[model samples]
Target chain A: MRSVFRVVENHRESDWTHTIFFDREIESTPGQFMMVWLPRLGEKPFTLSYLNAVTVKKAGAFTEKLAALEPGDEIGLRGPLGQGYPPLKRPALIGGGVGIAELRLLALASEEPSFVLGGRTADEILFYEEFRELGPVHVATEDGALGHKGLVTELLPVEADSYAVCGPERMMAACLPKLPAERTYFAVERYMKCAVGLCGQCTCSGWRVCTDGPIFPASTVAQMDDFGKRRRSKSGRWEAV
Target chain B: MIPLPRIDPPLINASGILSYPEVFTAFESAGACLGGYVTKSVGPREKPGNENPVVVYPPEGAVLNSLALPTQSAEDWERDLEEIKLKNAKLIVSVYGGDAGEFAGVTRRMSRFGDAIEVNLGCPNKEPGEQTIMESIGQNPALSAEVIERVRDETDKPVIAKLSPNSDYLAVAESCMNAGADALGCGNTLGPGLAVDIRSRAAILAGTTGGISGPALKPINLRMTYEAYARFRCPIVAYGGIETWEDAVEYILAGAGVLGIGTAFMRKSTHEAAALTRDIWEGIQEYLDGEPMSALIGAAHRAAEGGDSHA
Candidate 1:
């Protein structure tokens, strides 16, 4: 698998910086990611922020190199790997943070969508303009600093065709009540060392995040022992283990 | 990256590391790059394999697996062989069974594939399953010959009997060759071992006992490959803990045509296969090929003759 896009533009979209427009030809569904390798620096995995391609966020040094590249830049990329969200027959796009990327992509499948979004503050929220045509959108924010006080999870869709989410595990968990067991999916951002199944470093206990999955039905997360609870820290120790 | 012979692309992604190459036309790159695929060991019938949590990786990088073989079905390979699209590789099909009839049954079905068939003479986990070929043939030369003889008659393609390292390696290699196999694959994993989890005060694996492989088996695999080369007429496919291009070169020097990488692929995925194959080919082109294949015949010859540097 090779990366086909270059970081054409880079900008901060709040706390998390956004590599606004990379390559339009990336062709990933949503939630799918590309493994980027930087010469001498090593390789890391990032989720595709754009629905049809890769719109990476420039939150760190790795993204900085990608962000600094012009349209003619060449980089190593492999895969639109892992399962992405399937289109909802009806329509409900629910998400937070970069998790909104998946919901926005799902909106491409729907004639119109019910966008239920949230963020940390008013400025942190994104994709409102492009997704507004998808139908109605509801927003929530922590600290009452944005659209609604409390949490983005509070703006769960009351009724809709189906719901898709991406964000902190806690936010996805909060949306469980608003979604049917069969109609919702959450893209798990896991700590995976090797995406191609060899290293065995991404074992979520017995399940392999690389092989078993990165995307599963909402019910699947419920069945997992510690879905969103496990978080690793900088020292190679899991923070919330 | 170490300069080593890259064999083939990684194909099998089964629970352990054994590949069922005959299943798909192409293999995915997980690790190990042999020029061809060696199907996961199979039996004549369906294997329920060991109970759940059949494998356990202890702190020291040791694994204890009691995999009852839990393969789909032996005959399924026949159905899948047609779909396989192998290229420039000598597909070596590995089959495991309780007795000669069952072993031959898999080969007979695979005869049409025209791919070479390997008879798994000894798997450490066989007895408790109510059947075993190891005890019958592996422990005895006459019985081993009978089993190989039976499997040989079933397939028109080359038959390579995979011998166990636990037994007398040279004698076993000889017995299979005498029984009419075209080549020999030595050996299967080392030991019928056990692992204990101190916290639970219980055995780690479901069956409690399994085979040991990886770097631990390299020296022994080298010795056995040498012994098989010295004693047998049929060629030998050196297997066990071969992870580097240098390791593959050593096996080739000690008389292994194709080195079967099991544990390396299990740990690294099959991505190393093509890399290793290319490396070895170039090493040979740079050094080994035009000379007689027999020039690489023994450990003593390699050590004394300087076909390889003493690493």
Candidate 2:
């Protein structure tokens, strides 16, 4: 069922994060999303920040409609709709900028998940303490503002087990060569519409970005069309085949 | 003398027939004269259905499926319903479940969109637990009544029970009406209908036996629709083998208030039902220009009073 629901409530700019509550309860694997379109507003896909409390940055068109929404505002949503990250017992998580939302829940869901979160400057980091309370957290900002003076990838621990990572593709590229075979890396792709998998809109390489995966293993997406060391445009739109 | 009735919104379709409404809106000329969006059946829980290789193509005209109702959980179906654009379109839900409780729950949740909640009392290739659920409730009227009654407790929506022709059709249909069902969706596919490769002797579908649909089942569907109409007054939605408006209208004359079109949605990028819908709307408009829709209701009564040839 490609469940579409109305926005029951939306919180604009809550600590610089927009929290939206939908009447549709989305039970999903951590990395899944719904292809949300607001008619004339254009369509964009978002990661599951917190199914219980969905949050988005007031960044673009999709978020703007979401930001302008009042209680009972109607929004076209199709999902809880894609494959989410596989459950991990113990894992290390890595993310940067707004991409951290993709890895946050996984950090919260794991038995004990360690995380490395980074942003442009220390002040721009999204959820620092949020990750710290969930597990041990390491931080790195590009300007040497907070914990480390380099990119967040510089702070990623050399882990030999399970890991769920979301950040700039450059960061993912730097870490891919360092990853062990047993380790799992769940990455997010943005251009998903018809999250039900019927829409070839989000097809990446041989698989569908929407239904088959929004979160795929580094090994699986290694040679695949879109995923590697480079970030799928944060705008994450699909390219014409 | 037997009595007969006329059907309206004369076609039924699979639950999730096309991905979005664009396909239906795109080709509005394919005999989709009906006024309702007959949704692919949905449940209260998210069902992943069977894995891929779930659908297969055997021949140019022949096809097989084992799409074990690949769906989001049932709760999610309701979310989809919220944004649905029915605008003057009747909404019908074709639902299936492994047990009476599951069926009841799925139906009850969707009863908010009245019109009808087609209770699938007979889905042939369900897994063990679900197969047992359908057989147990469908074969026995008392059990069937209990299942229908359970759904009635939730909403006053018209309950359209989809009966499997393989079981005792007339009996199950009567039980559904007795339990407050307003209509019947006659004859889902037959007997874990089997198909195998002659050379390999192996089953054609991943699920071994699958529901036989398309042209292969038309004659049987027509026969069953006639039989159920002959015995019961509950409205009927005839499903199977309906490729043309003429085929659909034939079911209407026989006595299906609505009809379900499956299999064919896979055939055309354009829905044949769109053509059927135009024909139906035009016929109604032309008739209303000369007489009132109320006059059509009167005609139905006259047709019923005239000895029935429909059955």
User: Which candidate ranks first by DockQ, i.e. highest?
Assistant: 1
TM per candidate comes to: 0.55, 0.51
Q: What's the residue-level lDDT of B12 in candidate 2?
A: 40
lDDT by residue for model 1 over B60-168, one digit each (tens)? 5444555545444655656545556656554666776667777778777766764567777767764254544455667677777888889878877777777778887
Whole-model alpha-carbon lDDT for candidate 2? 0.60
Q: How many clashes does the backbone of model 2 have?
A: 41
Across residues B1-311, which tens digit of lDDT does each residue of candidate 2 receive? 11112324444455544422322332332445555665556766554444222333445443455544544555655655665654445666667666668777877777786466667677665532355334666677877778788877765766777787777878888887888887777777755555554433445444565666677777777777877776774566778777655566566656665666666544222333355446645654554476544333223434766876651
Candidates' C-alpha lDDT: 0.60, 0.60
lDDT of 1 by residue, A1-241 (tens): 3334555655555555454465556766666666665443434666666542444556667767765656555555656666666666666777776667556556776665787777777665677777676687788877676577878666655687666777777777667766788988767776544354433334443344544456667776676555656542211123464
lDDT of 2 by residue, A69-179 (tens): 777665555456556778786788878777787786777778888887888777656667787787777888888888888887776554535877787666776666666
- For the second chain, the TM-scores of the candidates in order are 0.81, 0.79
